[model samples]
Target: MSDTRLKISLASDRGMIDAALVVLGTVAEHCSAPLELHFLGHGLRDEDRDRLAHACDAHGCALVLHALQDEDFGDAVQVNENIPLVAMARLLLPRRVSGRVLYLDCDMLVQGDVAELFELMPQGAALGAVRDFYVLDQMRPGSERPEKLAWHSKVLGRSEVEGYFNSGLLLLDCDVIRSDRALMTRMTDFAAANDYRYMDQDYLNVLFDGRVFYLPQAWNSIWGRDRLRAKTLAELTWLPDAERTPATSKVIHYTGPNKPWKSQSKLLALLRGRLPALMKWRRAASGRYA
Candidate 1:
C-alpha cells in the first residue's frame, strides 16, 4: 500500500488554532497515517508551536511547520481566512513527498479513518472536490431570478464548468499538482479575478470544473440549518462508545456560520457535548504515541 498523510493549514490566530488542534487531535486518533499539520501565515507564537508539537507528540503524528514568509509568493493578494490559507497549501503541493496528501479545512472533524480517501484519487484529475450544498440557489443577487444560480448547470461546458464544489475538503494527487503549472496558474488567476462569495471554492469550481471527480456527499457531509430540517437529530449525532463504522465519508466538514462550537440550535448542542470527550481522547492518544 502507498503511504498516506493527513495535511491541514492554519494561522496563529487563537480561535482558528484552537479549532485546528481539536480537529487535528481527532484526525490523529482516527487515522493511522502520519499526520502533517502545516502552519501557514503569521503570529504563530513559540508557545503555540510548542503546544502543537506536544499534541503531535502525544498522538504519534509527524508535525511539519512551514513558516511562509511574505516573500514566498510574488505579489499575490492574500486573504487571512481559510480560503487563502487553503490556496497557499495547494500551491505548495506534492512537496518532496511521495503519494497523495489529504488537505482538510481547519473547521472539519474526522469521524473515521480517512486512509481510504487516498485510494479515491483519480488518475488524470489533479484532485477531487465535493459539490457545495449551499450553492444550489444562493449564487446570484437575491433580487435576480433564481435561474441565475443555475447558470453553471445550464451554460457551463462539461469540460470548463460543472456544479460548484466546496474547497474545504480535498484529495490532491501530488504528481498531477506539481507537474501541471497551468492548473496551478489558473487556480491562482481565478482567485484573483473572482474574489467574491465562496472565495477559493468558487474559483476552484471554475478552474477544475468537470476535471475534478465528484466524491460522494457522505465524504464531506456538512451541517447547517438546512441540514437540521432535512435529517433527524439522531442521524447526525455521534455517540460515545460507538464503533467506527465503514461509512462513505472520510471527513465531516462544518462549512457555514453555524458550527458545533457556538451553535445554540438543539441539534448542535447535542453534538457539542461529545467534542470535549473527543478532545480528551485526542490528547491521550497523542501522549501514548508521542
Candidate 2:
C-alpha cells in the first residue's frame, strides 16, 4: 500500500510563530491532500501550539511539535545575528521525521495546490528545489556583482553555478538525507568554519549541489526585486517544454530583507492582485497577511 499523505515540515522561533501559522493555514486552505504537519522550534507560547494543533485537527491532520532547548544544538554551527540557531533545526529533521517532507520557510505564500508537488519525486537525488533567481542573475554576463558570482562559484566548487538552488522550499528525501548524515554534518561544519552568508541556504546548496532535482520556478516563484526574466518553470532552460511554472505561480516566495509584515508595504497589493485564491484565503485569515 502507498501512504500518500503529504508530510509538511517547518522550523521557526517564537518570533515567527504567528507568521508561520498564517503560512501553514494558507497552505492548508489550498492543499487538498491529507496532511501530516510538523513544527520544530523553541519558545513557542502554549496558545501558538494549541492554535496550530486545533487547525490541523479541524482539517483531520496530525500536527507534531518538537520543543528544544538552546543547548540542544550545542554549538553545532555558528550563525550571524540575522539568522538564529533555529535555522539549523531543519538539518535535524531527518532523524526526527521520515519519508519525503516538504520543508517550507515561514516567509512563503502558497497560491496553488501544493499536493501536486508530490506527483514529482526526488529520483536518485536527495531533494528538490528551484534555482535562485538572484544567483542566476548574478552569474550572467556583466552582472552588477561579479564578486558574488565568483563567491557563489567558489562555494559551489566548480566552474558551473547554474545548478545552484534556493533552499526556501525544499522537497527533501528524508531517507536520503538520513543516509547521508556524514555529508549533511559537513554542511554545518562548513558554516561554522567560514563566514557563510546565506545560512541554511548555503549549507543545502553547497551540500546537495548536483544531488538536487531542480523543481519548477512556479513551485517556488521568487518574489524578488530583480523581476527575473523567467517567471514560469517552462521558461527556464533547464525545465522540459511544458507548463511548469504555469501562468499562475504555485508559490510566491518573498526573497530579500523586506518582508510583508515588516511594515505597511506594496507587496500586499501585489499579492491581492496576482493570486485570487490567496486573497480569498487571506481574507478569511483576516489581516494576517500584513
lDDT for each residue of candidate 1 in 143-169, tens digit (9 for 90 to 100): 334454554554344322225777777
Alpha-carbon RMSD of each model? 7.4, 3.9
Q: Once model 1 is optimally superposed onto the true structure by TM-score, how far is the C-alpha of residue 89 displaced, in angstroms? A: 4.2
Candidates in order have lDDT scores of 0.56, 0.69
Task: Tell me the tens digit of each residue's lDDT in model 2 across 1-290.
Answer: 12767899888888887667777876887898878887887777888787778777766777878887777665555556656667777766777888888888887778777787767763556788878767666655544465667867777787677777877788877787768768756644634533567666776777786787777667776654314535322244454543244645677775555555554445664654433433443454575432
lDDT score, candidate 1? 0.56
Which whole-number lDDT from 0 to 100 does residue 148 have in model 2? 67
Model 2 CA lDDT for position 109: 78
